[model samples]
Target: MSDGRLPTRRRTVGWIVAVIVMLLLFAIGWVMVRGFGALSELQNVRHSVAQLHKAIDERAVDRADRIAPRIAQHTELAGDLTSDPIWRGFEFVPWLGQNFTAIREIAAIAGDAVDDAVTPIVALAADVDLTTLGLSGSRIDLVPLPKLADPLSGAASALAAADARARLIDLDGTLSLIADAVGETRSMIEDAASTVGALHGAATLLPGMLGSSEPRTYVIAVQNNAELRSHGGAAAAFIQVSAAGGTISVVRAASGLDVPALTEPLELDDAVLVLYGDGPWRIPRDMTSVPDFAAAGSLIAQRWQSQFGTAVDGVIAVDIDTMRHVLTATDAVQFDAFTATSDSITTVLTNDMPQAIPDPAAQDIAFSRAAQAVLGAALSSEEPSSLLAALSDAARDDRIRIWSAHEEEQDLLAASSLGGALPHDDDHDVHVGVLLNDRTGAPLDAYAAATITTAFGVCDGTPATQIRVTWTSAVPEEVAASAVAPEGGAPGDLRTLIAIYGPQGASARGGLTTTLDRRPVVQQDITIAPGESGTATATFTGAGSSDPLTRLHHTPMLEDPEILRADIDCG
Candidate 1:
């Protein structure tokens, strides 16, 4: 009985062992299948990545092929304009002559290139199906065959899911990079197109005006009055010649005035000269009524004697209001679209009115609205031919008060009175000679003053001095010295030293008083040749200092007017 029981127990143990072995084998087989599947999936993912890279490279090549020719053409056109002789003499002409057709072609080509490059990228960005790209059944072979049936199998599955998520994230990043490239390309193309279009438009009109046959010459006479000593007591006389065939020549004539200190007068050999001065003088608001303002105009004529050989052919004087009206009429004011503060826009708009518009806020808003309307109209217009005309008409109809005197008026009166006092031959050039004579019949000692107001209507605080009495001679050297005042308080005072303020100021003092300092100062000076009259000048220097009075101080006031007293004629 004992032997039979032992044999049965052994058989039961053998059966238990056999069942455990079969279970182990089955687990191992399942793990091998999953491992192989994961390897195949990884290989497929790698192939997709390669294909994406290849597509990117192909797109880049295709874009380059389309863009290179346009870029080359643009470069070539720029180079041609820069080197062209007709354009070089006057830069605006070549700019105006720029081929709009070529520019448009380049812009179109660039636009097309950008569009083509972005098309595929945009598609790829939109085509991605995030759900499909996720790996629900994907697995990684992290567990050994023996450990396939471990309780941590759930953790291993989670790791595999994490790896699949990582791959999808990588694909998303690649797509994002492609999308950015496409966007950059599109932006670049747009910018290029805008730049080209602007260049083309600017060039078109600039050259014609610059090279026009109309004479661009201007002659100005400046005076200084010692009594009304503000900005060197200066006044300005300007003559602009717009006629096609008019000839202007300035000669240095000898008149009784000092030479060495005054230097030589600049001879305007067919060139336009603009002169400005200060004085206790009057200017007529209307040129048609010359007699009404003759006394004031006489002062202008007197000032011209020092700088010009004769009376200028034409004169047109427009004050601050007129200037503002012209600018506004031309629609030249511009505003920044981005980052332009309301305060800044308001300031510009309000400050540019004819007489400081009563309600500044309302005026600024109105101006802005009007400007918008005009701009909108211009943009909407099918043809821009009338744009400039409209602007000019606005300026003309703005009722800007101006003073004008022309040679034609003077010539007509002279012709009617003289009948034949002046030669009538058309070929003979008309000369407007100015003769300087003192009341006592002695050499005249002329005192003059010139001033320059900058684009922003700021006057320089310095005064130029031309002293001594002798004959008027062409002294070109005096131009610089006469344009600005000496650094020292007195130009002739031997003891008075001229000092220059530098970027780092340990003032530089010089013994030479006649030499101009050219520093930023509102110049005012009284030139007295012992008992003779002299000239003064003021220039606007847009410089600022820490002192409030000196901060951006552009207006130079003439402090003394007794230098030009009628009873104190030096002659």
Candidate 2:
């Protein structure tokens, strides 16, 4: 045992053990170095991507082109650094393994999102004169749309595949730091996918809907926010518009009151009938109170055909919020009494003009004029792209909804936010929904204020969720309640239909109200007086979500709603 010189076999074994340890140490050292490099590369990729977005947003195509290669380089480097045999081997270490695997997979997805999905779309956008791509004043260009279908579809598919992959990654079990990173990554990918998917849908659907192939007609409902409805507000006026090739002209305009109630109501989903009752089925103005824009569009279309014997190709509904958004991109629109900018458009439409022009017929004419003036301003806007951006923004906020009558195109529309169809697809986010519908028969909703918040029962990993709405009637005592009294309403009284949709597949138990789309929905009717307040809350027992955040998919109001959460015990 003490001999300085050993036997040949023992010496060979000693040499083998020494070499193995050296290799192991070298492998560990290599991984450590690569890890640092990969992190740096990823950081560079993030920075480059941000720069790329800025360039794209600024419409600096040349700058975006120059930035592309940097992103590609870093994404490739990050992927290569994380996917080597050594790195892959570390992914077998149980919980530790998932972190490594998630990192590696996210790196690949990042590469795919930028290089394959975003770059192609950006390139496609650059290939065309985007300044006039969507709308220029009153005209819509359909000439360049068909060419975008294939590439846009491919980009959407790639991003959608990437999003699906990201959603499958379990973040709850991962380290907090890594989980946050992954969640952010997932959100970015999802947003990209939704945007590209919508673009793809537009490219495929707009041709026919815009009457590129043949003449078409559509009904446009501009909602009046003074009288609130589920989709936005009471339909104030309707415009029958016809399109051929690229030009759209107003065929006719009619007040919502002109159309008589349906002697026979359009068939509604039993759930809708139970909750909305016969109000929607009875009155033309209340037809839009149904939340499903697709259904509401169809109902309006049917009502129009019955009343005017006109068959329309599609339907569009917009509120003052949409107009207010577009005013930011267009020139100031002049009303009878004042100039309306983005900040004052809502008041000008719903409050000032109606109060200034008290004659019902005269007020309707002014309403129609104001709408057309806004359109004329938008068509002549110096920055046409800005109008498109505004419209996209409004659509995302649920202030504008379009529904196609064509079967092929409608399928795509029903699946996207472009149509404002109530979510039919199963989603992962915890959903809390609230709807504020005016029943006071007055324009007093414009003077109302509401605060919506989320509450948890016990906060010990609470499964029960509560949605609280504290609504206040802010109408002043001196102001007239309404110019044209469609029905009797007190200036001091605010009556509303408030519905709180709990989490998906959850029940309110004792708080059970009604069911919509086979999902539990709680609703209540309340009346509040001026300077007074009312509160509505719904508690659902089975509400749960893997996501730390809850999604409040409520009706878009005149004021941007803030969704707040309160934890009873954990706070």
The clash count for each model shown is: 50, 1
lDDT of each: 0.27, 0.76
Q: What's the lDDT for candidate 2?
A: 0.76
lDDT (tens digit, per residue) of candidate 2 on 33-94: 87667667777777777787677767789988889888888879989999999899877877
In model 1, the Cα lDDT at residue 561 comes to: 15
Cα RMSD (Å) between model 2 and the true structure?
Answer: 5.8
Write one digit per residue (lDDT tens) for candidate 1, span 380-416.
4332223333333322322111122444433332332
Give the worst 10-residue stretch by lDDT in candidate 2: 480-489
TM-score of 1: 0.18
RMSD of each: 33.8, 5.8
